[model samples]
Target chain A: MISLTRASRWYGQVIGINDVTCTIQAGLTALLGPNGAGKSTFMKLVTGQLRPTTGDVRVFNQRPFANTHVFRRIGYCPEIEALYDDMTGRSFVTMLAAMAGIARAKRAERVDEVLGMVSMSHAADRRIGGYSKGMRQRIKIAQALVHDPEIIILDEPLNGLDPVGRKEMTALFLRLATENRCVLVSSHILYEVEQMTRQIILMDRGRLRAMGDVYQIRALIDAHPHRVSITTSRARDLARRLLEFPYILSATLDSADARQVTIETRSPDAFYDDLPRIVLADGYRVEELDSPDNNLEAVFRYLVKG
Target chain B: MVDLYLLRNALRDLASAKRLVVAAILIMGPAFIALAIRLGMGSQFDGVLTYGTLAALLVFGFVLPILAVVFGTGAVSQELEQRTMVYLLTRPVPRWRILLAKYVAAWIVISATGLLAALALAAVTYQPTPGSGRTALNRRSIVNPRKFLAQLQTPDSPVVDYVTQRLSAETLEQLSRWDPDTPAPRPLLRMVLTDLNKLIAADRRLYDPADFPEINVPDDARQLMAERPRGAANARLNRWLLEAAFPDLIRTNRTTGNKLYRDVLVLPVGAAAYGAFFLLLATILPRALITGLFLAFGWESWVPMMPGNFRLLSVMTYLRALAPHARPQTASTDMMQIFQALSPDTVPSALAWIVLAATTMAALALALAIFSYREYVPRDDAT
Candidate 1:
């Protein structure tokens, strides 16, 4: 487990992370936050690239700052696009594996394995300078996994990846978690994080706003109003019926379309359960229904505001 | 083991960099100049030695240091500028080892290039048959021509008559073409006189001192005559003349000695010291290139010109201290004067080398300390 106790890092009065205290245990955990939300700073702290300004951070009961013992067990995929572009993908991964203290005899096998794992074996012999954005991301991931560290911390690993690449990476993270390795991935895209893992640690303005499984955190913010949009031919009639339900806090018609209605509800679970009954009784031709607050973005907004 | 790995990787990266090509061209400048000089000018051993010395001075004193600074200062900063430092920083190896590996790699490049250039310059200018078979201009025979004439003024001076008879009319006419008061005799007259002097000395032992009593011997000659019986005085005088008049032979000896001193000692030590110092500056300063330029051009250049012990701060001063003191035959008097003025006072070669080694170690240690403690954040990540 990696733990941060009252960890605060300040760069000349601009706080990167302010008094953040949390523990990341074994499993795939998504670090969800907007840009400049202290996610990168937290990753740097955990990877031993930085030290907390006021508090303590420990990876597996020992300090990670310049701690080779901890570093050997941890793999970090940085968010920055920095790489030795002149080197072939295989050479780059092998070089890092060697630096990570892997035995010379095992470096080639390990590099090939990680490259295959990232589905980059086809382009492994090509120079990274000519690789596309998705290829670069995959090569970066391959280097991070070349050492087979116990903890893999990737910041924005899905950035620039295509749909298929994202699916493959998501599966890779799941496999890592299944093997009991701690996979803490930071991403600002809510849907991407949601697709990767249900466990998330959300942050805003350099503070940890919430941490838990997505569903559990969503349950905690049930008191807040949830926004759900409905598309139907009889939107005005649905809005009137939604007001009749006591759980519906407010309802509004779409300005451009009379067939669309947006409604707010105090109890999302109750509303979701009763929505089919109401539609069936009124015989409204509902084409689509989506609860904006059901995903991690709404959970983050509600928890940050609360 | 980790350091070695890092070093190997760094060397590989350096080999692929385009800057290495530029650096190689810069160091080869002296070698090209030496080859040109060899082709244009005749390979007179003294002339070649003078040219070689000047080449060594240009390379070791200025070009080598600038190259070392350019390469060494970029050793770590290049990684930071490209934002690839994070890869090495995030590795399990210690930060000091990373810095050290890069430093060693840079040193290897700079020293190898500089020494190779020096070797090429030396090889091009070196003469295999130095001071051999050049009897026409025996420098010893020309020394103190008036004294030689006075010695031959005796009535039964067969040696003088023989020399005058041996002189060709053309040579005599050439000798008379110059002003009588000129210090230097005509070339043919000088050669004939040199041969005459050698013959007289060889035959002098057959004659008694009383037979040449009118020949006024100088105090040193008289002491030599008293110290040794018979013709030993003439032999001593002959030895002194050969030693004094042969400027080419003296220059040849000095140049050979200087070449060994410079190639074997000064260049390697200077390259290492400059490389290490630049590595330290690169680690500690944000603008290492500008600072290094200032130190190399502005400070090192001026400090040597300052009066009285002020030059002790300059690396060039220590280098000059370690260099052989023989001035090149082609060097201008002004250049010689400057070199003499800048050279430190009687510093032993061993002491100078020790100072250089100590400074290199200190700079490397300081670089390691700075690299170990300093935090490097990628530019895009800095908030």
Candidate 2:
């Protein structure tokens, strides 16, 4: 587990993460928040790149700054694309392995293994200078895993990857956690991160905003009345039907369009999962069905505001 | 093992820098011969080292040091500037090993080049006969002796004719009436050719303006002639006079001791300068700008800030003072006065050695520190 206790970081007059405290457990955990949410700052603190201005940051029960041994077990992929551009992917990974003092004969084998794991084996001979953004991202992962590190921390791993690349990378991440390694992936895309891992640690404005399972957090947001607007042939009938349900907190019909209606409900799960079944049984003709809760970005915006 | 790893990483890429290696060889090889030949001229006239040893010392001492500077600085600074050094730094190995390996490799290459140049120079300039006589001074012949004599006769030629009549046959013979001295003369006179041979020759001699006329030259022109040697003189004339004075002028060939002394004096200074430069480049070069700048110009201003510590001005000041007094050691009691007047404290040999050792160690240490600082660290921003 990685923990930061009452940790605060200040660069002169500017404050980064302030009075933030949390512990991250094993398994695939996503660090979720909007931009400037202390997500990257907290990662850097845990990785020993920066020291906390107050309190403590500990990984595997020790300070990480200048602690080479800790890094041996921790595979960290930074946000910046800072790989040596001249070296070929295989050579670059092999060089890091050699630095770790691995036997010369074992280095090539390790490079191949990591390349395969990241599905970069075919491009291993190519210089990193020629790599696309997504290819560079995979190569970074390959280097991080060259030593077969236990705890992997990847910050903004999907920043420059296309949708297909993102899906493939997300799947690879899922496979990584299955090996019993604790993987913490940080991102501002709530739904994208939600797809990667349900276990999460959430922060906002340099403070811990929420933590625990993805569904539990979603349930908390769902418990707060969710707003939905619908347009259909019988909007008054739909509003009347939604008002009768215990989950619906409020409902209203548009004055100009008899087919349009707006409704607020405490449980999106009840309205979404069962509303269609209820409408079908009544033989109601619904032209449109949409919910603002389809993405968690809306939910985070509402929670933070409240 | 880790040191070896770092060293390998740092050195592996540069091993293929053929241009740098070739440049080092070219510089050191020819420089040996030039140095030896220059110094050989000095001692050859005054019993200095044979042309052979001068040749050898020039190559071994001077050429070697310069080669070391080029090679040593090239090892670290060139790689860093090229940005290719990042490959080695990303490795897990420590920095010190990388620096030491590079320094040792460059030093070996330069020293080897120096040795090669020295050996080549020694073989080429080596003379089998060490006791060869002094080189002859050449002279030109006056082809029209009678015409020259008529030309020399004064406008009062009748008076000269009367004096010539009064003179006896033996006196006339001694006076050389055929080649008389004249103040004004006619143009188309036939003259007999005659040669006046050279009187003396001495190599390795730093001729003084005061002693030039001792060789049968005009007394008044001694100082004027001292400044320019063989101005507008042709090679044939030089050879004829050298042949004429071959026997009498042979005694003054320079001894071996003078040549050795000169070589020895320049050897250490040249080596020390080169070593200092390389050591500086090897160490924290970026930081070296700070200390080197101070050493170059800042020390003087900084020293007076502390009233008692004025050794800041010692290096250049000592060199300038010693330059004018470059004579061989003469035990004048005034020497003590000269030393006392300059400074109460005398510079000790042991102190100089300590300072050199400290400077070298600091340079190497700084190199190791900078090199190591770059190694085994992730520069990536992702984590």
Best by DockQ: 1
How accurate locally is residue B376 in candidate 2, as Cα lDDT from 0 to 100? 24
In model 1 chain B, the worst 10-residue window by lDDT is B214-223
Question: Measured with DockQ on alpha carbons, how good is candidate 1?
Answer: 0.45
| DockQ, all models | 0.45, 0.12
* TM-score, per-candidate, Cα-based: 0.78, 0.57
Q: Candidate 2, B165: how far from true, in Å?
A: 52
Residue A139 displacement (Å), model 1: 1.1
- The lDDT values for all models are 0.73, 0.56
- Docking category of candidate 2: incorrect
Error of 2 at B3 (Å): 3.6
User: What's the true lDDT of residue B259 in model 1?
Assistant: 51
